[model samples]
Target: MSSTSIIKVQVDDTQFKSFLDLYQEYQEHLESAPDDWKKVGDAIGDAGADMEDFADASKASKEFLLIAATQSEIISREIRKASAANNALLESLTKNVTAQKSFADQAERSEKHMKELKKGASEFAHEIFGLGSFLMRLGALGGSLAGLGGLLSGIGLKDLASSAVDTQRSARGLGMTPGQLTAFNQDFGTRYLDPGVLGSISSAQSSFSGRMWLARAAGENMGQVAGEDPGQLAANLAIRAHNWWVNTPASMRTAEVLQSTGFTQSGFNLNLMKQLGNTPLAELQRAAAQYGSDQGRFNVSDRNTDAWYGFLRQIKDAGNFIETHLTNKLSDLAGPLQHFADAVGKDVTVLIDQIFTPANLNALEDGINGFTKYLGSSQFQQDMKDFAGLVAAVAGAMRKAARFLGIDTSPSSSTNPASIPVNPGLDPDEVQRETRGQVRGYGGVSFADKALGYTRHKLNMPSDPRAVLAEMDAKNGLPAGTLEAMWAKESSEGKNLVGPVLRNGDQAIGDLQFTGAAWKDWGKGGDRWNFMDEAKSGGAYMGFLSKRYQGDIAKALAAYDWGRNVDKTIAQNGANWQKGLPAESMDYIKIAKILNSQKQNVRVTVQNSTAARVAVQIMRPQPNEHFYRLSVSV
Candidate 1:
């Protein structure tokens, strides 16, 4: 620990070089030495033990030990300093490494941006060149047009050209050749002259000349008509002209002919005068006057019958055209068009039937039938059937169409359901009673009269039985004590008869009375049981009574009695009762209730035999002659 102690150490060039090299190397090693600290510490610890083991040696060992101790001390101090320097260098190096990575990432992003810019520039250049090529083609076409001197040779352009320096001015004065004028005239004539219009036109020469001028004007402005062959244009134009003449108004016909022939308004007037000077204005005026007079009164009524006949002829002709010319010509487009034809055919059939009267309807039917046979002979039976059904549907639609047209014939009822007979006046009750008796008799009842009698007797009873019994008397055709007497009879029977017989009798009586009440009330005035009305009103009442008794026997019997009475009444009065109360309506509610209750009761009885047995055993204990609360909780 003394600062005065001289520690001898050997040093030479190699050692000094080693020391200098090692010093620099040590600086580097120190920078990385934190990685090796644990190994360095272990070596230092071993050296201290080696120094102690040599203590047993002589004076020479003592001298060596002193040098070794000083050397160890110096080495240990250097190791500690190197360890601190190495840690500091390592921390600095980590910061430099992170900074380098950040720079590299920024460089990569800049490189990617440059690549996208280059791609965009390449596309912009390509579009510019493509536009340049299109402009060059247009420029070349213009130059070629300017060089066409041969085509303009016949026009005496040099003389006119001096007077009109501009090319447009010179071209405007040019005239068409005789052939061209004639071709123009023919084209306009065909276009404007439909058969009907041609038939009406006066001053034929003027009409023809006007048409010629109009065609020339149209050709000059619109180019030759599109979609027409050069050779066929003349023929097509002639047909078109004929159609125009047929359809055009008298005043407008001459003007349309002039316009189609290419004449200006002034030119048309001059040409018309030249063409028709010999025809006399009075004759033309007379013809026009006749046409004008017919305008409002114009009707095809005189020819309507013939027109319809002709219409049928036209339909047949068109159908034939479709099957022959069109089908063959447009074989590829035929499938869908054929389907359309079938639809149109069906619609046509319907139109005919609707427009025609019943007397005339048979003609339409015959036409349709004939068409069907035609279709059947071809490969379109399915198509025909579909068309026929559609036509049948439209038969009614034609009535609406006829109405719109102001035709006043009766609407055809070919497809309507058969009409029912009208009922004359008759007693509904008698009719219903007779009908009921018949139904009962059919069901093996021997006494039809007895059945009717029983039904009638039950019908007269009041709905509130207690009220009825309370008010009963000989005056009302019942004994004063009749109910009391009946009650006594019932009690006696209850004691003597088995449970089943008593219950059955009670059920039969209740059912009979319920049905009789329903039937009697069905047609009675003032809230009486109209079977139809009761059907709607009685739903809740029926449900309540069914749930109250925990059974539907009373409801079923009520329905049966109603059904029987209605049937008897219908048979007795026939058509008369049919008008009053429909026999079907009478039976409807009753039958439905009976069947529904039967199913429900059968299921209930099967599922709960005990309930069924109890119901059968207990006689529904006769409802008291006087109204009393009968409480039973389910």
Candidate 2:
């Protein structure tokens, strides 16, 4: 399988803003006037009651009454100061939370990238190990050859061959004519073959050396005369014949050559002599060489008595060792050769094992440790964090610019960083004109002027539709509760983005239930996104929809659900537009209409108990009042 690289999850500015908004809301709720504030007032009142009772019981204790009044005033002042301090703290916490979340995002990307690098390094180490093992095996083969070569050097082939060759006599004995013998002797003296080969054979003092010499001679001569390459068996026989011919005394040379040619004295053959005489000189020499070469074939060099034979002993002993101990089963090996082989093999095997032992594996550990050291260093970590921060900052500026120009620059879940929006379409002015539209609210006030915080009454919507809708309306001029209610009807505000695929197998994504094509065209540019990105895409598209349908939310929503078909139906049917559309489209329109109707009853308001509101309420008291009432009645 091909290696898998780690993926980075990008969160753009638009997405961060959405998450920040939600988190801020939760933090606001937490920092609101805690329920225990009432208990402080109740405690003061009880203390005041006790003081009054003590004064009454003591008849003339004005000092106790004065002390009680002073303490109450001081406690009330401290409470006000604490309330102010809490609001400041909440603001500080908000900023820290945003930065920490961004840092966490950077960390995740670094971890995934490191994982990919580690996997690649592991594969490389495995390949290196395999190469090391092969080299070790090759070393073993070389060691075996070196041992055999050492034994061969002990045999003195050079000294023997120097004294042995009488090339002229030997060549003439083989019946080479006077001219032929002279040429042969000249080639022998110049060491055309090997000058020391004759001495090496003579030192062996065995039939085996004689056979080896003749075989070598025949092979050399055969290549010269007929260009016929001799096999191992033919070469062995021919060299032996040459060894015998070269060693014989000069006077007996011709007789030995004739005897080798199959001419026998017991036969007393004048006819044989006549037959030999009839033969041409070249034919007679060739016949004699062949007869002597063939006779040498039966000689066994290593088995017969021979002088100190270093080369032959080394070759013979090593071949036997391999056959008995190495190639064959271990149990079948015998004698000192087997014991020597076992000792060498064991030593080599142990060496190989040591190379890969746990102690040695520290070398491999050092490699991985070095990789991790670089990855986890402060400099590297800071670089990654700084890069993420830079991207977020740049993205924020781009998003702000895009928003000003009315482009839907939002987060996309595409892992490819290139797909993230930097600067979107050309013509910012035209884009703004197409995107943003004026939104009017109750009594002709701009949507931006209206506050929906007061309308946070309980509702059955999946989330707080009034609060979110009001915020969108004020900030982006969306019809209040329109996007929220549309979301409630479409996908319960993105709760089902990953599930409940359409019967046609198309997945509805984001709060507005954008199909794949709709998301591509208007929602945002990505294959996937978090809930915050989905919300931004859904909100951005709603603004564009408002512009397209001339600020008629109901019809624009109908078009959003029905696509171009709604426009076509309306054009053809006029007053009966709903009738001309498909049943699914008609049902979609009904659902959107129902949502629109429900949002009408929802008052545009915010949660009354927010920290800022509670603090203001606490600070505002009647000017003449020395004591403020605490509502501990509940």
* lDDT, candidates in the order shown: 0.41, 0.48
Q: Highest TM-score, which number?
A: 2
**Reference-based TM-score of each model:** 0.17, 0.23
Candidate 2 off by > 4 Å: 1-470, 473-476, 499-507, 595-634
Question: In model 2, what is the error at residue 202, expressed in angstroms?
Answer: 54
**Global lDDT of model 2:** 0.48
Model 1 whole-model lDDT (C-alpha atoms)? 0.41
Q: What is the C-alpha RMSD of each candidate to the true structure, in Å?
A: 39.4, 43.4
TM-score of 2: 0.23
Over 4 Å off, model 1 = 1-386, 411-593, 596-634
* Cα lDDT tens digits for candidate 1, 76-181: 9999999999999999999999999999999899889989989998898676455445446646754554444334333433333332232222122222222222
Please, what are the lDDT tens digits per residue for candidate 2 over residues 304-421? 2133244346566876886665555434434544555676799899999879888779978998899889898998899897676556655565556657765444432224434333
Lowest lDDT 10-mer window, candidate 1?
Answer: 498-507
